[model samples]
Target: MSAGLRVAGVDGCPRLADGSGGWIAVIIEPGNAMKAERIDRLAELVDRPEAPQIIAVDMPIGLPKRVGPNGRAPERLVRPRLGMRQSSVFSMPSRAAVYAALDPRLPDEAERYRHACSVARATSEPPRAVSRQAFHIFGKIAEIDGLLRERAALAGRIHECHPEVSFWAMNGETALDLAKKVKNAPHKPGLALRRRLLAAQGFAEALTSPLQARALKVGEDDLIDACAAAWTARRIAHGQAIGFPTPAERDGEGLPIQIQA
Candidate 1:
């Protein structure tokens, strides 16, 4: 393994308004024991010689279509595998909806309807309810859009992934059904499951090390999620990672809309 080929995993702090809410990243070499860290700005953080050869993010990359209010193919393809926890996979609003949500004059419902309508009409998608929770991350989504559109080198290196999907792949192995994000499980069962899986892959330090723990800005779950994403990043670096849709669909700009886990 050369020093240049690194893999990274990233997760966003959901509620920040100014696009500086915070982001956590875990980096590991393809064949090394472990090399992980948390950072606030993902694009700027990895802009160097040691930048990841592959980056798997927990946010949506390719958005849904607006042809007719239809939802994103990636979310639709992945939901069944999650079973009762399908709620974890929300419909990605169309690019138009995202831009509309950013307008200062639009109220919450009006903006959401605008997004729903835009995605459906432009992409021929079915009208999917855009959740307020999903709308909240508009800022973070915008940040990634800026990165990909501007940086030609990062276009394919950074992939869209889901931590929930990754957790299922790690814990279940079969991919038919998998783990949950544990919204409020006692003793944090979801976190524990994710930690145990990463620990098995030599990432115990990423979870328990004092230095790493101090770097976690959000809650324990976010830290755990970043680690899970790193585990998936390892698989991606090793050519073992699998995508949700074998033949993924792409947005108008040609970015893939598949979840790799």
Candidate 2:
């Protein structure tokens, strides 16, 4: 507990365009309660640290198993649903795949694709359909590419903001899911309490930070998810207990993997 802990969180709206594709936020706090005395204190804890433990990001850190007809590849893979009209979809990679791809890029390339496959799968839709959908979402024929570029830029910004923390990728699935996960995860009393406090702070920040509010285009759900990810990082850093995935649990893929903190 001598050195403080640093954690990062990222949220992505794969379906959305407008650099508003999603949001990423990082928080660093001291082991002591006095760390919350001021906003500047919190920023200093994250920015000035030498090499802290645990940074969590909420993006697809790898490419999907398939490629779109437009020759654009998925940043992460998701399962196909019946009657879904989209050519490429927003899906998550398997935990094994995510860990494999992201672990090597810790604290950098936090947005790069790492997995390799012998063959690339093609999308079901035609090139024109893909183009139409992209245009519909982004308001222009070429906006889809612009959105992807913006997402990458935001990911790069998060990495640059905290170069010293060991980054981990996290996608809570949902705010409620993240809340339940962190509430049940085991942790030292001090760290656990700190997480709760951080959660409250994030909730507040969501309302105040113009960027987060504008990106979410809604209430504080995104903030809650970001905070929950930070709490999960705290539990992971302390080597504390974490919850298990239910029998029905699955990643962006329908495949199963072990859950950890």
- On lDDT, the candidate that comes out on top is 1
> For model 2, how big is the CA root-mean-square deviation?
14.3
Worst 10 residues of 2 by lDDT: 159-168
* lDDT for each candidate structure: 0.68, 0.32
Which candidate ranks first by TM-score, i.e. highest?
A: 1
Q: Per-residue CA lDDT of candidate 1, range 161-224, in tens?
A: 8877887787665342334344444234555566677777778654544346445445566666
Clash totals for all models, in order? 18, 3
TM-score of each: 0.81, 0.34
Tell how far residue 238 is off in model 2, in angstroms.
1.2
Error of 1 at 136 (Å): 1.1
Model 2 clashing residue pairs (backbone): 10-58, 78-91, 92-252
Whole-model lDDT for model 1 versus the true structure? Answer: 0.68
| TM-score of model 1 vs. true structure | 0.81
RMSD of each: 3.7, 14.3
